[model samples]
Target: MARRYDPDRRTRIIDAALRVIVADGIAGLSHRSVAAEADVPLGSTTYHFGSLDELLTAALRRSNENFAQALRDSEVCAGDADGGEGASSGARLADELTRVLGEWFAGERGAIELEYELYLAALRRPALRPVAAEWTTSAVELLSTRTDPATARALVALMDGVCLQVLLTGSAFDAEYTREMLTRVVDGCA
Candidate 1:
């Protein structure tokens, strides 16, 4: 006979795993600790996830979903700006990118740190790199439609640099500063 499973309990375990990762880093993740944090029996963890890798995979998927949603939302805002409905005309597109980058950098350091852990894992675990690479590709493709491909790549790089700067220094780079830099870059390319 098959064992019974509690879907809600399973979700709680995964969420707890994420919290543990955020609080203690992925290196510290373990069934006993996660079970303690989730307030579930340790057996429930083994029953729900069978293995640590399985749990991490699920967590990574959840993280990717959140990133995907953010990218889509950013793209929608960019679309509105493209259609001239947002406040800044064509400039609105760049401004939206700046805002998205700022919010992602300043507000979501846990996610960023989680992402760095994922990156280190990807280096050692080949299966994980594509998930992140695909996310980067989608974001770049969205930006490239408004700006040239090369410039779009540069824009993404600048955003990443600004994010790292913020994460390291606790400084908020002004969104307009990026907007102004992109304006000059895009204008010069025209």
Candidate 2:
């Protein structure tokens, strides 16, 4: 008799790969490790992903999709804010961005680490570069809804720097400081 195929197996493998990457870093990823992590047979890993690079790319894509969805759900965009009669749209945009960053720093440190790992991996893997690029594009597009392209790019860079600093120092992320910095960026754009 033929073996049954699990429809969700591919997603499970991708999610397991992310867990492995978060726990052991990108250097530690392997078909066997992912299979063990997913509790699937090794053949499943190979069958779903022809190569480790393919697997890593899929994992990064999945991570990016999840992160983007979280950002969307957080309503970080200007449209979601209740801009009162007197509230400056720019200020509201900055506040929303600061809230998003604070939530990300407070809750998604592991995912952020995985993002950085994938970013570094992309530096070496040409195919993975597009994944990183797409992530950046998505962020910039989100920001561009409230600001110009230049300011959007600058805000994205600032957010990346702040995230890295918070991650590196192992210090508590200060939302007020982030808000102040982002407000300055928004003001400069005006």
Using lDDT as the measure, the top candidate is 2
Each model's number of backbone clashes?
Answer: 0, 0
* Superposition error at 90 for model 1 (Å): 5.9
Q: List the pairs of residues colliding in candidate 2.
A: none
Model 1, position 176: C-alpha lDDT score: 72
Model 1's C-alpha root-mean-square deviation from the true structure amounts to: 3.8
What would the C-alpha RMSD of candidate 2 be, to one decimal place?
2.0
TM-score, candidate 2, is: 0.90
lDDT of 1 by residue, 73-141 (tens): 765324543354645533666666776666776666788778657655767766667766765777678
* Per-residue accuracy of model 2 over 73-169 as CA lDDT, tens digit each: 7656637356445767666777777877777777768888887788769888988999889988998888787789888888888888888888888
Model 1 misplacement above 4 A: 1-5, 48-50, 75-90, 105-108, 144-151, 184-190
Give the distance in Å from residue 95's predicted Cα in candidate 2 to where it truly belongs.
0.9
